[model samples]
Target: MTTYDYLIIGHGIAGATLAHELRRRGRTVLVLDTYQTDSASNVAAGLMNPVAGKRFALAWRADDFLTAAATFYRELEQRFGQQFFFETPILKLFSSVAEQNTLLARSADHPWQNFVEELAPSLPPAPGVRQDFGGVRIRRGGYLAVRELLVALAAEGLEQGWLRRETFDWNQLVVGPASASYAGDVHARRVVCCEGAAAVHNPYFDWLPLTPNQGEVIDVECSGLADTQVLNKGAYVLPLGAARFRVGATYRWPPFAEGTTEEARAELSQRLASMTDQPFVVLAQRAGVRPAVRDRKPLLGVHPATPVMSILNGFGSKGVMLAPLLAGHFADVLEGHAELWPEVNILRYHALYVAARKEGGFSS
Candidate 1:
């Protein structure tokens, strides 16, 4: 039989980050992951941006999130000796003068103004690209190598005797008010679930209003495109290491099929064709359901009824940016060193679920 001070489930960015934070605090932790065939972290582009979309509003808690995230990743990279983050400028191509004006006007007053800069007026026209709409450069943003980081952390955890590469069985789990345990020949003081969309099946924390959106990205081997830049035009064309680029992220409110759909492939093909002049080969296609909430915020904290069981998910598309900060906060809360952020605390969602249950409507 084996015992640990803490147990973490799932190997996604959220789980990996949390495990690292706990380990740094010198806690004996065990990470249990089933290595699900379909995983969000494995397919994530790991883009960390302070702003997104047409509105160009600042990402929620951009300052704190970015600072904490960058610092966390830098420290981890130094410790692990791997490149996890790269500060790349994102070129957001505008569609019309009105859009560019909207961004420029907001840039003056927005906190992320420094991130927005004007590109060269003599920028050459790109074939199959909308050049009439000038582009806005967003500095201090870039992508994380999500898969590599997760793998490295998993290996580190294993070497430290803190990783279990197996499926966690609910039947062997005991949930209590102050602590959780697994009774199947192994024991742990506390168990935290980081299972992405599968958290829906969790008996305790499933009440949160989660709108899972499915998205897909395609890998293309293209040359002559700028390096270390994410070109955003509706969908982003990200420069993957080597000469390959990732073009995608088609959002489907409710996923139609379990895997990549033909429609999505065709849609991506069309979008990529319009993004560059060079003939690109579609190397691969992948999909994952985002665990986004209605308000587009993450859900973190202890379970209201089952305090023994806790969850750290709902990172959605911002997992890479939010994980480092939220994971540290969560560790503090668990260790009785600090409190949870109200914005991300699951209490509000639990309240909404209670109200909805009384009204005979689904919580989400």
Candidate 2:
């Protein structure tokens, strides 16, 4: 049997980042993934904005997360000889006078002053864009080519013979006091589940309040759209080169299945139209389910009852920025160097797990 220090399930941002971090720390790791093309990480536009929401408030832990994410992606670029990370400014268009005023006021505030700046007139104008009230230029913002990055990471893992392309069966997992064996052939000191939205069906973690959300995005060929900066208002218009842009996304709760819908396409197209007058042709549409949680925080750390089994999921839409920082912390916890953050610890749902067990069973 092949032995490893860690066995990770899923190859999305969470699993890929964690595997990279653990391997960097000299751990023997094995990654198993079915590599579903419609996974959230595959379809995500990878926008890493420091400030978000219609109110222009800074994202949670924006400073720390942005700094770590930037450094991590840059290092990955150097290592892989690829250009997937783009550090571009985000042009946050104002939909109303109140929104613009709120942004201006916040720009002058303490922490916001560091990242928020008034849109400079010197910047090239976005033709056909609706900017009657103008917009603020947010610094320390950018995007990663999530799909490309995942492909590169998976290639490296495969080349090293540490990544397998297959579905991981939960019933095949045998958890011991200090180790777990998968398929009765692969043995690992610990198993980390990063199965994304699929974790809702995981018997070990189904009780953790994972609310899978289906999100859709469309690829459009807009000839006149500017690629200088990411355009955002109600929806985002991310330039993907070749006169193409990725416009997304519509969130649907209780997603029955993973597939694109006409409703989502219409929603995205309408949002895109509201943001710009540039005529565009929709080239393709894609859909995936994000591993969202009830509290909107990432779920991490070892399982309460099974010490050998752990999790690093529930990143929702912010995986691009959250993955690197959280992966480092999780690796530290796995190495006995730190503890899981209280808010994100799976132990927070211990009572729910017990209740489910008592009630005969729970449905994911």
Each model's backbone clash number: 0, 0
C-alpha local distance difference test of each model: 0.79, 0.88
Instruction: Give candidate 1's error at residue 20 in angstroms.
Output: 0.6
What are the RMSDs of all candidates, in order?
2.9, 2.1
Question: Can you write out model 1's per-residue Cα lDDT over 127-213, one digit (the tens) per residue?
Answer: 445456677778878888888888888887777777878887777887655556675655667778898877877665667887677
TM-score of 1: 0.91
Candidate 2 segments whose C-alpha is farther than 4 A from its true place: 119-124, 360-364
> Model 2, range 1-364, lDDT digits (tens) per residue?
9999999999999999999999999999999999888899999999999887866667888999999999999999999899988988888888777776665665655466678766532334668777778887888898999999999999988888999999999889888888989897899999999999999788878888898898999999988877888888888888899989999888899836559998888999998888788899999999988999888899997876778888999999999999999999999999999978898898888898888878857422
Worst 10 contiguous positions by lDDT, candidate 1: 119-128
Question: Pairs clashing in candidate 2?
Answer: none
Worst 10 residues of 2 by lDDT: 117-126
